[model samples]
Target chain A: MKAVTAFAPATVANVSCGFDILGFAIGDMGDRVKVSLSDQPGLRVVSITGDGGRLPLEAEKNTCTVAIQAFLDRLNANQGLDISLMKGLPLGSGMGSSAASAAAALMAVNELMGTPFTKTELVPFAMEAERVACGAAHADNVAPSILGGFVLIRDYAPLDIVKLPVPEGLYTTLIHPHIELRTADSRSVLRRQISLQDAVVQSGNIAGLISALYTSDLKLLGRSLKDVIAEPYRALLIPGFYELREAIQKAGALGSGISGSGPTLFVLSESREIAAAVAKVSEEVYAKIGLGVDVSVAEVNPIGAYVIESV
Target chain B: MKAVTAFAPATVANVSCGFDILGFAIGDMGDRVKVSLSDQPGLRVVSITGDGGRLPLEAEKNTCTVAIQAFLDRLNANQGLDISLMKGLPLGSGMGSSAASAAAALMAVNELMGTPFTKTELVPFAMEAERVACGAAHADNVAPSILGGFVLIRDYAPLDIVKLPVPEGLYTTLIHPHIELRTADSRSVLRRQISLQDAVVQSGNIAGLISALYTSDLKLLGRSLKDVIAEPYRALLIPGFYELREAIQKAGALGSGISGSGPTLFVLSESREIAAAVAKVSEEVYAKIGLGVDVSVAEVNPIGAYVIESV
Candidate 1:
């Protein structure tokens, strides 16, 4: 098969109630991976760019090549592939950058082949690759990266993941400060177990947020998007986290929360105007702390893991 | 200013994962309460029927009348009134029978008093009345009875509840065994402060269920409905609980679980035909178990508490 380049969007995992089980893909901010079938029987990593000399170029250590090899191994077919990683998304930025690379590489290689697996079936393989990068097999990022839109990782074993429909007019404002925090380091700050009372409250909030999402009741969504478990512990890492959230809420954003693992925050709004308003407030809040940030006003991209280019 | 009669549908609290936070109203099974603005100096409970003589006749002890008093208190005005409870739904049937009475009374009185409170404000009053009956403040039954569809009780204080759009084409099959289980008796069976591990699993299941409901994935909904916390202990109260669930599942119901506190098993199906089929299987299962049962197969009654008779 000819060479193909694909893009997998950045995902917001641990979406309040979903924990490691839910994710949604961003339509605009993501990474691209290029894959081509090789005549040789050994997988090879071609190059890695746009990562500021941080990512490893070794085929085994690299997330993209490891994901591609896992995809090939799943089919019991020994096929060589040349993989290139163009990391448009920042690494360790809490925007699901690593997961997007892993998902994109696996998807690109699968498409270059005859497509031997279903989208649902391929998630585990992609998640395995994510584990190589993050030391955990979590589907929140991989599911949305591969399937697109809102996804629920219903089960890890026997791999039941669901891609739910995003409500109409759904837009997101993503604010990323120029700060890096490893997913492992960020996860280490969390308590191994929370109190049952707190868990119940968190679970209720999560369930309520999802119910609001389905019903398209923006007010309820805003009210229910509270995170009693992860947010309280993790918010200390980002400067002006509380102020930014307050500003976002004041600007009429339905809800705002930490994006995945950290310097990035996401606000789900009903329109570009509201998103822009949220972005403005968020930028102002961050600027007060003397931080430069990139804010992307994007929509929930329904179509995930698509071919970006072919050569 | 005049007399009005209203009915609110029965509901199931602890909707699988929601424990005490979610509920939906049944269209056909409910209690009718009539309220009349009278020239009398104090509220009067004139009659109670269809309750097997188990309910209290005193206005202070009755669930419906307590709801009426709460409604009156919210207005900060004391008014004399006459209330009659037409106990259409069976009492102590684990089908939110008491909640229906409380909700019905609130609806009837609200309309009778010229609509001073919105449905959102009315839930706490209804829940308060339910507390008088069940010994705790719970909104699962009251919220749905008042709002008419699937309700996620995000918060009880200041009364934040989210009404989710019921998945389209959904139908319900309920099997009410001749046996009765009191809400108080069921409450005594629970252990306070469950393990944190168990709570996490339960919360995860609840989140999955909410996602499934939103996505309208019947299979996911069925799979996600497994309750690890309350159902295991309560299932022993219902005869043929596991067996009936199996039979109904085989007979085309997506899933079946103990409704509210006991004696009643509810099934969710995609279509009316499937719902009927599941109901038949449920009836057969109960019959083979040598138990008398009443099977009611109905679609989700979208309309909630409303005035059934005008003055």
Candidate 2:
């Protein structure tokens, strides 16, 4: 039997000023998927670990199998397969947990199928899985998880994804607090109509961030990490959010903002040492607030998803 | 007497997706200003030409003298100066006529005073001139006129302006229709509030535009040059706006949009020949509507304002 195991990195979406359009992959944490051919003529979820028995076991319900099924349907391949998922990221943690699983499964299944689709071509399948998981087919998380580095979802109709350059020494400190904030609830809090002034401010920040990435201007990147559209309202859902951000800023981190929706925060730093310091500050702030948190400091993952073990 | 004459290029602002924040300088068409020291204790306007005597001769009301006065006040220099304004660009044409005059005057006066401030530092004084001219201290016209190339006004509170790279072989075709459109009336037609969905689309286009400029991808740039925020409502004010855009697009121009507000339109092209072709197409479209138009094709001006003669 041909077997393959793949790993996909977790991602931080929104990235401050780039709500619903920008995201970047992070190193050292993600989801893993192992796939093997089976005699049965349909896909099945053999096992799912690290999700605390919360994720669905059914193939159609699971993001991993759903993504694999999408790829198979696109290729018109009906080879029976068993998929096992290992979720390293916390569910509902704003760390792209579902996207990581779907990306990993698609990578494993694609490798098992002799690599019919390129990584860029795999993004739509992952987005389809996103639609199954979160009811919104956003590529901010899935594209970065599959293609690595920074990804900009320019448009969703034709699915335009642009990979941006990552500067050297750029590191991130992510803190996921042990709290549940439904994506629906977080989204419901945003104003459907925003002032044109605020919209102009948001666009200015997006343009600045893109320019900063191309020029490798860390200071400008920090300055551009502002979210006037979503953050002002979403901050009310996360406890100690402002305190943690202020502490991280004082700790020499370049800038910080809500990772995706709520409860997870990301701090950008120019060096590993500063990232570590920001991580420490994040921990102290959360500890003082009596909130348990999982903190990780990692450089940007330049290579998103890859094969781990193939047989 | 020490005299300096400077020239500043006209600019095209609101480049499709980058409303209120983006602009680029155009070559071969602009305004000229001459400043000379006098024994008198205050500034004086010696002459004004090329405006059909429509511009004010009073130093306080003119954009050139007002900007020069601002610069002189900043330097605390009490030296008298005689100013000469020659407007090469058509007024009320959406071609940044006021900005060019202010930028040229600032460059000339700055040189006349021994060049105390760099070009970047002179943007605010030029913005002040914009306020005197249009009642808004906008940098989209002034920044590109002073600094050259594509300039993004990232923020207004602290005046953060970023200069973006111009791709090789990129040219612009500008068509100025002989129609009167007040800036205030054009601005008033826009909605004060917009939906969140439209804001996201606008930001996506902006990020994509910046990324395309960095990568030098003309196709992506053309795709990203969409304006959902300002174009729909403003298009009603311009005669045959949609027809002109469609014709230019069919003529192989990358994209086209209203230059600043209306009446003047800009078409971005990959080469000068295509730009010229698009200009011909634009003229034909306007001619069918019985509207006379002034058409020109020019590359992006990389050097903004410069002293033409100093003695």
Poorly placed runs, candidate 2 (over 4 Å): none
Runs in model 1 deviating more than 4 A are A115-118, A177-182, A270-297, B76-79, B114-121, B176-185, B188-204, B211-216, B236-240, B270-296
lDDT at A206, model 2: 96
Q: Global lDDT for candidate 2?
A: 0.93
Worst 10 residues of 1 chain B by lDDT: B191-200
What tens digits encode model 1's per-residue C-alpha lDDT throughout B1-311? Answer: 58899988877667777777778877587899988888887788898888878888898899888898988887887888888998888776777888888888988888888888888788888888878887878888888988887888877666678777677888888889888676667766766556545665666677778877666777777877877677888888778888887888788887767788877878888899999998888888888988899888877777778889869
Which residue pairs in candidate 1 have backbone atoms (N, alpha carbon, C) closer than 3 angstroms, thus clashing? none
Query: In model 2, how well does chain A match by TM-score?
Result: 0.98
TM-score for each of the candidates = 0.89, 0.98
Note the DockQ of each predicted structure.
0.41, 0.95
Q: After TM-score superposition, what is the CA distance of residue B77 in candidate 1 from its true location, in Å?
A: 5.1
Give the candidate number with the greatest lDDT.
2
Report lDDT (Cα) of residue B53, candidate 2. 91
